[model samples]
Target: MDLYARFDLPPPPPPTVFSRDHTDGRARMPNFASVDEVSKFVDASRLWRHSRGANDFLRFGTAYLLVISLLVAAGILHKIYKRSFWVFRIVPRGHSNILIPNVHNSWALFITPYLWILAASSIAHIIGDARNEPVVNISLWISIMWSPTLFAVWYQAWGLIAARLGDGSASFEELPGHSLTKSMPSWLINAVFLLLPVVPSVAASLVGAIGNAHLEHARYGWYDWHTKYDGTPELTRDMVLDAQNIFHESIRGAYHVCISQAIWGMMCFLFGTAHSFATSSLIFSIGDHLQAKRRAVLAQKPRIIPQALPTHAPVIDRSLPQISQSDFSFKWRTADEAISKPLPSITCDSMSTDNQHSRIETRMYTFGQRMHDQHISFFPAIKSSSTIVRIEASKAERVLNFFIIQSVSIMLGTVALISDSLYMALHSYAAAEANNYESAFITGYIAVVIITLLAGTGSFISSTHTTFEASFTALLYARRFDPGSSDISSSGGERTDFLNME
Candidate 1:
């Protein structure tokens, strides 16, 4: 039968009570008036009084197991710490002085206090359970679990800010789309970063609740006898056989519920991981595209000239000129005499030589003119708006904006995750108590530890990647916009003469 069907409500019943009279002097007591009477009698009887007894031993036992698991996980985190420590030391030596204040760093400031809270909560829960007392309750756990989701929302806002800063185009405001800057109002953006982690954390909490409910139903059936006793009791063959069918049905229902809860929790984990990876990948891809475009522009060579100029004069004007001294006394030779007396027979070969020399002189003169034109220096117009000082100032403003937003997000996320983990751990134990199933509590504890460790590791990796990418992008932009200072020459006269001759 379906689990929902099993939950069908039963018809109302009349009340009655059980009474034993010694007047009959019989060894056996008389039965109750009705089913209601029997149930009421059972409810009122001291036989089920042990149900109120606190299972302190079970609580402490599970708490200790969780602590040990955390210790083992801490060792894994330690290895990461050692590696990161070295990187932190080395990066500063080569890194630029401009440090983007990332919120991830703030985790260091509050991590100790956060860990203490978690440890204290766990211990309190264990001690309370050992003494049959309630430590942290469900309301507190729900609040804790939801914290991380809030942090994720906060981080998303930071990402938006970073996106706006890294945007290359100056007309971001005029672009034909909703601008990241304009569309996301300051309050709304901050709210989103504040609320992001809440979704996954809430999902996890819901799943955990379902798991607890399932365990509660299972323990009620399996340990129904023990609920009223300190230990397992032996039943007669007939009684045990009679209870087997109901027990099996309850167990099956509980198993189904627990499985569903597990699936739900797994979904939350997968979703969170996917979001983190997608965000990081997008940032990386955009940065790479920009860098590639810059490189392509820089690699192109300016157009080049192919050949050198030759040194020679043309002969077109070289022949002697006939002068008449203002058309008076000077005699000029006749055309026939000049032609016949062409000192050496002006042969085709000679003419060819004269043509070649003329071509050479023309080429040299043209080259010199080209060189002289190139030598004229025009000062590039100084537009204050396009100056390096203005550009750098703008970049600095953007960087500061991005850093402030991103850092807030990181800190919030870290706190939320840690708090949620602690809450879940305690909640799991509570669920186990409600069900009187030791295994359920143990399994839940293990799951919480595993999830916490995974989240911490994920955060650490994501922060590192974001940091590196941001640094690389900053370096790229710096090189592009600021291309360093150049030296100027002082010898002006010599330079001018060289230019005129060229």
Candidate 2:
């Protein structure tokens, strides 16, 4: 009322307005009708930008590192590091290995480079960051994902091979299943499993040691301290203090690197253990299915029992066949049995009493039971394929292995965190004076947090997926080869539910 009275001016347009790009370029206004709408708009814009930034950064860094490593490995390093380091070579067109196949070679193509990048990058970044240098870039940091990726590739390549071996043929359908190292003895399997974690753990430790050495060299100059501080205790106190500080920082930095290595190595070992279990399951399933198929084939075959002696044959009477059986209770006889009989049938008087008939039935049942037991004893494979399915499909082993890996990783992370916290707390005054050690500790703490979270998710998802796929494959094979078992279908349903729980 005041504005209208003051000057006959039109009300100003709402803030939520935009011009439409059209033939007329007309202005359009939306009703910001409710607070929800405004909030939604703001949220959408903010989230989109945030997601885009993170995605772009990761994408750019990964590609940059991958390309650079590939160029160096394939173009430059290939000539120098022939067998010692460069073990992979790209197959020329139409020249791929028949046994290994191109898919594997292609996978190794990417994975080998990634491994190289990871091994190099971890050392470089840890050393640089420890020394408080700006040498390590964002791209190198992002490439820390190399170890997990390596685990995945290693699992896949070996898993596929194991599975195919279980299937006993190179059919496309059987190309990607798992199997136990069946040909190997039990001792070999145990030995390999036990030794799986050692190599990577050792390598990580060595790398950490080298990085620590580098840190110490960088931290402490190569001059005689006694000469620099002049031998007097009072004059040398500050120098001695700095030396102690440098040594302490070097140890801390090295410890951080070692923890990271141990974490990744443990992860690799976890996958290795999972691979062994899955392979064993697959082999068990394959064995069951094959045995079932063999039994079914054998069962269908016509068995010819030796012709019994004349006295052993069932008595038959062709004469007075009109009666079909005389007082013989008129039991029907097959045409072949009637014709083969050596003697005529007995009369009604020869028919056995009811008690005798019961005794005979009991004898027949006992004989059949004895034969059944003997069959199972002779062919242990006669057990239902459903049991095999159940054993192979259980996710318990995979889950247990995963929890072990997770527990170990968490413990390492906690130790690293505690050590860093203690170091910072005890040297708070000196750290503040220098201002570098505190930052290093904080950085290490942050790294531990990020790595712990990533490792947890990566290990769980990858290991679960591998276990599920291998088990599912075994189930399919079991069902296909052992169609008589209704239990297989039910077990398959249970497996689906169990995987959903994971």
Candidate 3:
């Protein structure tokens, strides 16, 4: 039942995987030995700081925001007209820009909305942190989380974009043991996410948005909403009290701005993490599909996999195959040796032709240098390495990586559910004894419920992602399009042989 047994490699490495510091280039800081070493380290540190100044960091940070917004705006335009699209070649790498593959709900397309949510939530965070308003001090901190969070996502995104559009193809997977993206976690950004629950009630922030968040239990909060009512209408009298009571008793005014925005930010972040993780998982994502095709090429044998709506090609009325639950369970049922050996990496490229017969192409690719066993992993560990078939994400791998990710989501969901239950139980007593508090309780409650849904949905999708992918992968490995087979469907001109990548 051990997933690692099926592979040619060992089990997933532990979270605290320790190996030699394989950082190349002697340009790094010197270890403390003598005063000279300390001086040398200090000098190197300053150089790094000077090279990547604050302004540069801010520019990169803001640039990413603008790029996401522009993508969303352009998608709206393309979706409406379908043909009135103009590809803005920021750094056009010959004809590759024109051949951008049309994947089924590419992350590049949907990612915009998630970023928008983060931006919206960030506004509330920034508002809460504005010292000029009430002098609420910064009391929160988030560990930049380079391996799996901000740094991982950023460099991978950059690499994928750079490789896909710039070079040719890009492949990636999560490796908690591997190193890279270790610039320093920006204290400025980290501190901004941490804001005082109220003036003078600020508590010091811990790692990763864990601070004294202004959740609904503040002693006092300023209410910011007002509506002129022609004397409290008789019918609306009790309802008004209940709504106000809901803010104080249910969520407290703190939940309205601070807590909800933070939750929104958390949920969006997980969504982004899921996108990056999907590259290695066998989910129903475009990247996964492309990966499936790549695996088929490396398949010592042919395979038959479930297919989704095609990309860029004409809409097909015919469904090629469907991955049943039994098929998915087969992978997790036990690591089947029949399962195809995944490549170290696969680079997928999308090319649109000028003629009507345009189709996504998978050109042959070869990895440069393969990391051998016993060698320490270091910066840019994403190089030609692979994880367990994420579609068939083994128990070994998810036991740590996926479990941790899902646990965070589950924990948030459980807490929110519990909070609501307690609020309901205490609402009447608190409302009866209430005097005055002007917090957006109803609005906050709505946001709270939405946040719960976000967490729940995110967890469900990730949990099922491996299942769906594993099942689809199982079906493909067992049966593929062969002209000799009776049950196999037509290939629809899709290539079966791919050399590493395109």
**CA lDDT scores, all candidates in order:** 0.32, 0.34, 0.29
Name the 10 consecutive residues with the lowest summed lDDT in model 2: 356-365
- Error in Å for residue 133 of model 2: 17
TM-score for predicted model 3 compared with the true structure:
0.24
The total of clashing pairs for model 3 equals 18
Per-prediction TM-score to the true structure, in the order listed: 0.34, 0.26, 0.24
Against the true structure, candidate 1 reaches a TM-score of: 0.34
Q: lDDT of model 3 at residue 486?
A: 26
Runs off by more than 4 Å, candidate 1 = 1-117, 125-139, 152-157, 169-274, 286-438, 454-502
RMSD to the true structure for each prediction, in A, is 25.5, 24.7, 27.2
- Give the per-residue lDDT of model 2 (tens digit) for 31-129: 334334323332221111222343344344445445544543463344333321222211111222111111122233444454455445445444444
Off by over 4 Å in 2: 1-111, 114-146, 153-242, 265-273, 298-479, 483-502
Q: Alpha carbon lDDT of residue 458, candidate 2? A: 40
Best by TM-score: 1
Which structure is stronger by lDDT: 1 or 3?
Answer: 1
